[model samples]
Target chain A: MVSLSDVPLTKDRFQTARAAHLWLVLLLVSVSVTSLAVGASGTSLWGAFAKILSGQSLSQMEKVVLWDIRAPRLLLGISVGAALAVAGAVMQGLFRNPLADPGLVGVSAGAGLGAISAIVLGSTLPIGIVALAGNALIPVAAFFGGWLSTIVLYRVATRGGRTSVATMLLAGIALGALAGALSGILVYIADDRQLRDLTFWGLGSLAGATWGKVAVAAPIILLSILGAFTLGRGLNGLALGEVTAHHIGIPVQRMKNLSILVVAAATGAAVAVSGGIGFIGIVVPHLLRLWTGPDHRTLLINAALLGASLLLLADVISRVIIAPAELPIGIVTAVLGAPVFLWILLRRRGMVDL
Target chain B: MLIANDITVQLGHRTILSNVNFNAQPGTVTAIVGPNGSGKTTLLRALSGDVDYSGQVLLNGCDTRQLKSWELAAERAVLPQASTLAFPFTVIEVVRIGLQSGTSGETDSVAMQALNLVGLPHYANRFFQELSGGEQQRVQLARVLAQVWDPVLDGTPRWLLLDEPVASLDIGHQLQIMDIARNFAHAGGGVITVMHDLNLTALYADSVAVLAHGSVLAHDSPMQVMTDAILSKAYECSVKVNTPPPSGFTYLLPHSAGLATVSQDSL
Candidate 1:
């Protein structure tokens, strides 16, 4: 109901913002399509987009490339990107720590470990069985893993239903490290092909994305993100800090639990699909914070959009930079993101926090 | 009326407040004064039902513990010593928090009125954390005022608990805050505040409770509890009660005494 990042686009005309946001969303979509169409094959960007939308029959190779190759991959990138970003925004609001991301409760490493176990075991089974086991079972395991960490962290930090940001951060760091170690152990046990698969997967790419894969990740991402949007009001209440939140009857514990679940499910799903892409959650919210203030309504939704755009743009660059030989989107994001972080740091030099 | 009964609080196995009992009529400004770690804040927390306590608190003849959180919230508001806002809420948004205790009915209007009462309506769109400390205190007061100013609960008034809210304010804002507290009490609200300024306590308190070592040392009218002996012993310093010319109203002024005995009767 209340969003901590609810900076109404116009301090006056709040309702007008949806139209603008839609326009921006559409503009980004066009950009995404253009990036995909103008690939190494040198297809005309508008002709490819027109052909894709108009139901014009493609040649066998074109059909395979467009529908099979680019389409599902783009959707997966967009959806997972949005999920990771929104999850990040919510995490920052809940913890009151700007540096915190969706993976704070070991979600990333947990997901990575779950995915790795699926890969190692999948090698022993049929390819379909392994793909099913890895894609379906891994996210569920990752979800529970994230949920367990959140509960433990909540208990360690909370007294009388009020959670401490500092304690949660410390707990998150410890848990994340532990999960990372387990991921390492899992990686160490893989065979040659398994190791190759894990290596490239660990680096994170959209190459494996099919519509079926998008379908695997989409429901969890969509539902959790929508749920988080509903918490815009509650998140704003949370930003007031716990005592006042309780004073205003926010049901602080319940809100924290709900936020954790949403964060876990959303981040878990993203990690299950995207591998351990770091800092989308951290950077998106930080940038949005500067633009939208601390209100979550604006912050949450903007983070989702900006993250989609950022990931789409990142994926496009990853695809085009190496031509047919693509770089992982994860590597590209970190390469691009670190410089922005540095710029913010330098601009605010001597100021305590950016 | 607001009543704090048999409230006992322990922290890390040591009793911070033990069996504290007190009551104040509606429309009265009650001041709680004590030395450091005397459990004044703990008592306020207990009364506000912000933490666990051994006993019950009653507001307007209803048990605070038994009332649903939303039910209890409509009848009282507490402003702690420090409220941290991590979000960049505008002044209006900060005050709007007080309105959530009840229906959102006419709250924007009332919030504006509360801000206007604090002489801050012009800053409605300004960021809350950007304001000066005094201004922030005023905005916080405005928010609490909106909470207690309920139309449906008009017949029976609510309570206000302020925990040293004026500590960071300057002399002008301090007096302004004291005036606001006095006004709120005079308007049939039960008001309790912990204050260190003896002069302020004398100025606004209808009844004063002095706590020492987590116990009530004295509870009575200002003149009764604020004698030279109690003042000197409470602060462990020599003090002179000053009554300035023209008004003849008394104020507390600390003094240094070296190996000499003095009497109030001499003054």
Candidate 2:
């Protein structure tokens, strides 16, 4: 019985992916525990557990702090981080370049535009339409915005199935600048409360995590992340180019469509809830690829785990850095990640295929 | 048998290939030869169903378009002229990508065997991006070979569609790759290759399809097709076809139009 497992290459790759899954799962679990325990509120998960074990009813403060505040934040963080990282891996695979991160490619900015518009221009909408859309408006608008930008960028940067890296980067910059300008105009007109909310949201923080936001973002992010995992084999084949991927039995067009949708949905959901959290998308995938070679099957899953853990760790830092005056999580990630991105670019100067 | 009937391809306002017909029986090495832009690769792309064309390709009595991608994959494998990896995958990993959708049902050592066939088994652990152009070409060939490991499965012969498989190779590797194609045909599979080397084509190809100006000039045995007149006209140069006495192998020498008679006499 000559099974595929007998092949050395298959065996090595299987072992690597399995090992990555094991380690990354452990990392995620530990990070989740740490994130639950450490906060400026000083209501530790250990304290609550100790009281529960000693058979005492929990106080209102602990319950509110732990369940109401930290739990939803943790879940929301995991979903956003995983969504961003997996979306990054998928976009890189689709563009066939390491630098094709959602944040860098203007998809995040476009989604941010959708979200900002929903917030600033939301009250002006027709009463019937606003009532019908209700809370789903922002995420839905963000999804459409992300989808539109991705399509435009793809059309502008790719011709005859070949994507030009220079063109893609240039188009991304142009799109980002345009979206930023529009966002500036909206920011200028916002009232005081809305302005405060807009400013914090634009900086990207997890302070507003609520069960309602979790309910909205979690299912979409989960479904899209799982969907992205199914594209592992197709993306691996696509690394050889679209025609060759088709020749090797991958439905290239279908995979491309699914990838774009998956990236758009995940990024849109994450952006709607977490605001413009950048670098998790680009940095997580790049670090994971360096650790384990770029097999999308393992890379997507590993990126999710590592991305979640790293974001939670960053969230912990954001909570303590100013101690009760939380620096936005986005600042922490950029401070840590931008240097790594530059180092990778410098180390791989001529090898980037651009 | 692989047959392409009335295959025509148009890109924008220009016709790349026009009403071309070609066929290859199993157990033979067929070659497509032409000038730089004579649509050799385009014809192969049409046959492989990699491009849209206004014609039909039948593989072993079944229309290629009618078959699903996996079904077509089970019947034939294609080797592109060159391939670039998007990420740094190991040689073995790149080769393993071939096994994902293959009809060769989970064979134990097929990937390794294919690598060995391409003389790259030892290079399995090396990153594919670090290899030279010729080595990378062979690794891709190994991948293609691994896809259709059993050339004949379930009494139906599979096919190898190679587009300039040895274009980046040295002379030794070129001969090595040609031999692999020859062996595949000898083992009851079909081999259709687009070749740039006329002498190598004459030495190895059982049948030659000469293409020029988006049309087939001739599809015949090498002995019948490698004439000086056909060669010169197809290439628009003064090409002399010679068969040396001892080995009975065909060769060609290309020269300027004015030097044709003088060069022939000297030869």
Candidate 3:
């Protein structure tokens, strides 16, 4: 199927395996510094490095910029990017549709509505009341909203007890439309600031990444990400078609459910932290597949790496594009991701499906 | 042992398989043949736990319905009529999936041996989806061959349920598959394959199940089921059978008055 360069390096080819592993590790290693240092703020790379290494209390301005702002935002970008990429890769496996997205599966939209409802209802409740309501209100609403759409989609898509791509896609489309309409109606009743906030959040930004946001996102992202890496074998079995998957003792139904739950929750958590970032879920697995083939073990980890790198780079570009104000991360990804996606598509016209 | 007792399949308001009964002991090939829409794949899918059906399938004295997913997989493996994998995997990688729930699954030597059985050992490293239809079929066979397991307990029996596995292969490959199926049965593994080729059935099938309109019209040896009256009725074609000069199997021919009855293909 491929020439010399196209032939995938096998695991036994220790040199080739080492080369690819080293390259991906290098990519991952390379981006950790970029995430920490590249930003629009006053914390220079040397300053942040010196502050941490020197073990000295920073000036008030430096402390505020580093801890309160840049640190959390960078962490959020990497986490959310990783979450979307992993969720997207999972969805691609779940439905065997390369084009499926975390949002299209209704996870993102449901979580968006849930978090927005919390924000909208927060104004009416006092600070004294907010503490009582916020803890129970936010994640519950998000989980319930996301889970409801997922359950409905699963039922409609699975016919005579088997899940098919055509049915999954159709059901996803129907539920997505219903969620979009309900979200629009919610936005209709909002006040001026709430309206602006909803619009801006829907366009998506990592602007609200505080320590509190990380506190909420960290555990969910970590657990789902771990589960994804562990379940790589089951996902690869599934891509072989359901009968073969079941014949291989894969517990196809259980794997399907696990995939949906893990993806929806991870996507919901990411949406809760960083609003609705679009296109990342739809494209990352595809690019990952191009780079590493469809073996899920490599695809899952590579997805996390490339996704983090892609979004971190997108964040950097967003910051520098407008000197004083940053563009929405969603806009930046679409502008950048679209060209790469189209380039892949155009170059492969009538040549390869991926 | 494999048993399907009065299996009935209903889709929507219509019945697809109506009270079909069949069973097979170890070391036998129970060839299931039927016209299109006669529920061959449906029956095979039911056997592999791919569908919810009424009635019972017992394997090695255990009810299949009660078996866990992994248990059923280890005991009975089914090759559907056609499997076109949507993902990109090397032929070896695809075969390795057959070891999902089996012991000795990680041994590439065993997998390569299985591929060698099907004359595809050299293609083990080739991309599965890159192969032609015929090659892919052989590769899938190798996958199943790698999946041989001890799920029948320390001394229990193993079974293979295949649905039209050689539908795309050429004549020589088809004969090789027939031989392989025969070998599996002769070695005390139950082999049930759905085949459309009557000549192939005559050549290799130890027993044949003629399914017509969701019901078994006949269940007997190929010599009994391939009679001119039943063949003409089931296949809707005129046919003639010719005995070999020595003692080979009968060869089928088109029924025509001008051709000599003894000439198998003179028509």
Candidate 4:
């Protein structure tokens, strides 16, 4: 029989948590450097470092390739990765279930529908609205779509102040089906060019990332990530259940509202910019929970770092595997993350009821 | 002092508690006892400000509904009947959740002390889910105990509102937990527990409130309230009260209806 006294002490756990965070940070930096170097242009990371260290100027083409094309894509990948991961962590905490994710909650489907609608119907819409949205129209529409679905799902799942996780999961599946149906109708009507755009967006890619798109997405993602940090304590209290959390002086209702809003914003922005990147949101937080336990304070931060690094590493693989032609980032993440997720489930087979 | 005055709780269309008046003074253990489905838990929940009710709950003369969330947390801590945690939280981490109200002190020391008081000093490091049911209940009790570790704060006594705190504990741990409650009351804190064990209630609670069908049937000292007539009527069984030689404590032994009919036939 396993006894209570066999567990590790608080001091030791804290030390391990700190060490885990430090390692993730170090890994992120190394992966980030590799991400900046590995591209079709063949600008070596060490060569760039040497040039910058010696105060020497790079050729115009090298400067353009490194600073303009690669930098924006890397930044976008980092932002989108961190956003999705943090959104996943917050969603899991809010629902009080490890299996909850943005995709499971229909945010990705809603965003996909929004992007597809924009791709297929933008020219036919009122010129005033198109002009107003300008170059950021697709991302804006996707954000609104994700946010609206979240609100609808939240309203449907919650009755008289209590949010039921089971109901939310069921409702999310229904909503996803509805959104997928709408997206299919839009895809069916699209011309060949529009069809290609829809296929690429559905698969998710950072190849289209530019400084302007990054600029449009960065603020919403950053603010929501910042907002998630304040929720750690409330989420911790909520682990005991809602009534207990309320008894412990957490404003449970307000916390729930804020958590939902932040998750929606972060996920909406990420899906808007990078399209529906899978696995990072769900898998990163689950893996970290295993290593550091389920303390959300550390979990959120580590998820962000690990999520960013993993996406960057995946982006590098997407870039180099086919050289001039890149694989869609969503496919790369799914290819890499699916096996690891399966391993996690297999290892914890009997322990989790899921 | 904690006073719940004329409280009535309605869950949907069903009225769970009606016009129930109860009070617990500082440095006293007040037990609320009833049969299953007799509104014991509901009344306790209303008193703890965890449910919507029609009447007023005042803690130290301040209406509980008027108090802010953190303010109420500072004044009292509640040990719910059952807590389900999704993640594998260590015992100490679970206890520290009680400190999230920003109560100041050495959190680790306070959590350890509460764990020690519950006779699980070495269990601080264990995963709460890994513990047995009774042990989980004690860990929850420790969480609440750590929340209001100080008996008296700013000249106002703190309160512990427990619901079926010992329902899952074995005899030894039950006594240990009851002693912990008794010690808290002895140290000038107040405790209002919903209990089913009549003998334990008689032994530990200074006062007993017998509730039936959403109303307070009787509220008085244990000896006054634990009479044979009241116990038999409230519990729907024949009960005999026994007084041992030296202790002068009350004990109630319930006779089942089936056994009573058999014995009556034999006689």
Among these predictions, the greatest TM-score belongs to: 4
Chain A TM-score across all models, in listed order: 0.85, 0.89, 0.87, 0.94
State candidate 4's DockQ. 0.56
Residue A329 of model 4, lDDT score? 96
Q: What lDDT, from 0 to 1, does candidate 4 have?
A: 0.88
Any residue pairs clashing in model 4, and if so which? none
Error of 2 at A262 (Å): 0.4
The local lDDT score (0 to 100) that residue A248 gets in candidate 4 is 91
> Which ten contiguous residues of candidate 3 chain B have the minimum total lDDT?
B100-109
lDDT of 3 by residue, A1-354 (tens): 223344344553222333555676677656766756666664676785687799976777777777787778777788888889999999888777676787876767777777677767767767887776564455556656776777778888886567776787777777878888887787878889988877777878887778877777878888888888876878878777877888878888778878888887788888877777877886888876666677776788877777877787787778778956889888999898788778767865664434
Question: How close is every model to the real structure, measured as TM-score?
Answer: 0.87, 0.93, 0.89, 0.95
Docking quality (DockQ) of candidate 1: 0.35
Better of 2 and 3 by DockQ: 2
Report, in order, each candidate's fnat.
0.38, 0.60, 0.56, 0.71
- Expressed as tens digits, the lDDT of each residue in A85-189 for candidate 1 is 898889878877665686666667666766777777655667777666655665566556666666677788787667777777787788889878887887788
Name the regions of candidate 2 deviating beyond 4 angstroms.
A1-14, A126-137, A151-174, A352-354, B101-108, B255-259, B263-267
Q: Model 4, B187-215: lDDT tens per residue? A: 99999999999999999999999998888
User: Which residue pairs clash in candidate 2?
Assistant: none
| Tens-digit lDDT string for candidate 4 (A20-97) | 889998998898888888899887768877988999988787888888899999999999999999999999998888
Tell me the lDDT of model 2 at B209. 99
User: What local distance difference test score does each model get?
Assistant: 0.76, 0.88, 0.76, 0.88
